[model samples]
Target: MNLPQSPNNAPDADDDLEPVGPRPRPKGIYALPNAITLSALFASFYAIVMAMNGRFETACIAIFAAAVLDSLDGRVARMTNTQSAFGEQMDSLADMVSFGAAPALIVYQWALKDMGKLGWIPAFVYIAGAALRLARFNVNIGVVDKRYFQGLPSPAAAALVMGLIWVVDDAGIKGVGRVDWAAWSAFAVTLFAGLSMVTNAPFYSFKVFGGRRSVPFIVLVAIALGIAVVSLDPPRVLFALFCAYGLSGYVIYGIKKSRGKPVSVIATSTDEPDEEGLHR
Candidate 1:
């Protein structure tokens, strides 16, 4: 009285069953690296808020703090074996806001605004250069040498701008209260920095951590003392120092290139290469 099986059906039904594939599940998130990235993002957001509130010095400091946090997140990820595509992209986005847009806006509002249409030009230029630098970094991540950045890093460029602002604010270099000339000069400086960020000049990528051999204790103490001094008057000291660092790369590179030296020659990274870590 049993029902007949279809012609296509196997007598041993279990034998005819297909293997069950692994079920798809949601991706697991890494907490530590993501936390660092979130902190960086918050730092950048706070910088913008401070800048808007006319707390220009605080905003600049916030941006620099964000840069420190931003630098740490990637290293932390690599050290903890938690590196991910999501973290890399997030870091770049945070950098664009903190280093790219924030500095440009701060400069524009603080000084460039007096230059009328010209004031906005440098802001746009810096932003565009930052975008290009980030895009190039992402694309060449695994292809470029890590020991040297292809161009001036965006954070350094932002630092230069903020440092200049801090110097001016601290020094109380006034008399431009309603002057177009001062505003235009600020705009011009911004434009130059923006262009420099994307230039082919080589900048020392302070990527190496604690690998230096043979430094006198006195030299170390002197460096620490210098940092302390700069901290006391960061606007004047740090700004001038970073500005010179930013410009020096271009001058050195130009001289080298004119003397028939190859611009692409750069120092190689000592660390083992990862698919995600590349510099050109």
Candidate 2:
């Protein structure tokens, strides 16, 4: 009803219209990537359960499985263009379980538990390092160099701790809690891994290898040989490889420092240009 038309024939304002509220958040998550993350979380849970049962070898294997799944989920999310904030948060939380708490608990249960009060030190330090590392990574994701990680990644640190257990357990070492040398070695490795994670040393992330870039034919051959070697003696070889990697950050840091190169991987905050796919 055009009862009170203005000069431009505008309609009279109504007083009965309901005010619009803020939009509701969407409920569901992307299935494929999040499912992989959930699987990783389940693997961590299984590892903890296995550790409780004194099945440490199985527990170590479960953590490794979780690491593999953890690595895949992000790639899968990017590949399928399903990278969501939800998936990112889920991945970080799953990582905390798999790499943070699970390794600490497993290592403690295996060897550290025998050390009385001293045992909890390294275990607690390891978990704390994981928490700090994860938090730093999340905050620095966009600013840090893609070629390098700020420090030893939590998954790799987890591997360092779990690999010690796996190698000893595979060697048929029984009653780890009673073995002084083994427990001491576990303590040292766990401590080293924990400290390595919180350092400013830049670790090579290997992100460039799988991307759409051309590498030498020797790279493929090297990967194949590496796999074959790992398959021969999974426990010993994996532990050895991870051990080398555990020390690599400091080596790189030393080299960079000696050369007077910038050690931190973080980009300068001049223009703050957002790179595509960097935030997730």
Question: Which one is best on lDDT?
Answer: 2
Best by TM-score: 2
For candidate 1, report its TM-score. 0.78
Across residues 1-280, which tens digit of lDDT does each residue of candidate 2 receive?
Answer: 6477666766436635645788654656899999999999999999999999999999999999999999999999889878889899999999999999999999999999989999999999999999999998998887799999988999999999999999999999988879989999999999988888888888999999985789999999999999999999999999999999888888998998899887878775544465332332
- Distance from true location, Cα of 40 in model 2, Å: 0.5
What are the models' TM-scores? 0.78, 0.87
lDDT of each residue in 109-193, candidate 1, tens digit only: 7887766786778999999999998997787666565656778889888888887777666666653426566566667777878
lDDT of each: 0.77, 0.91
**Model 2 vs truth, CA RMSD:** 5.9
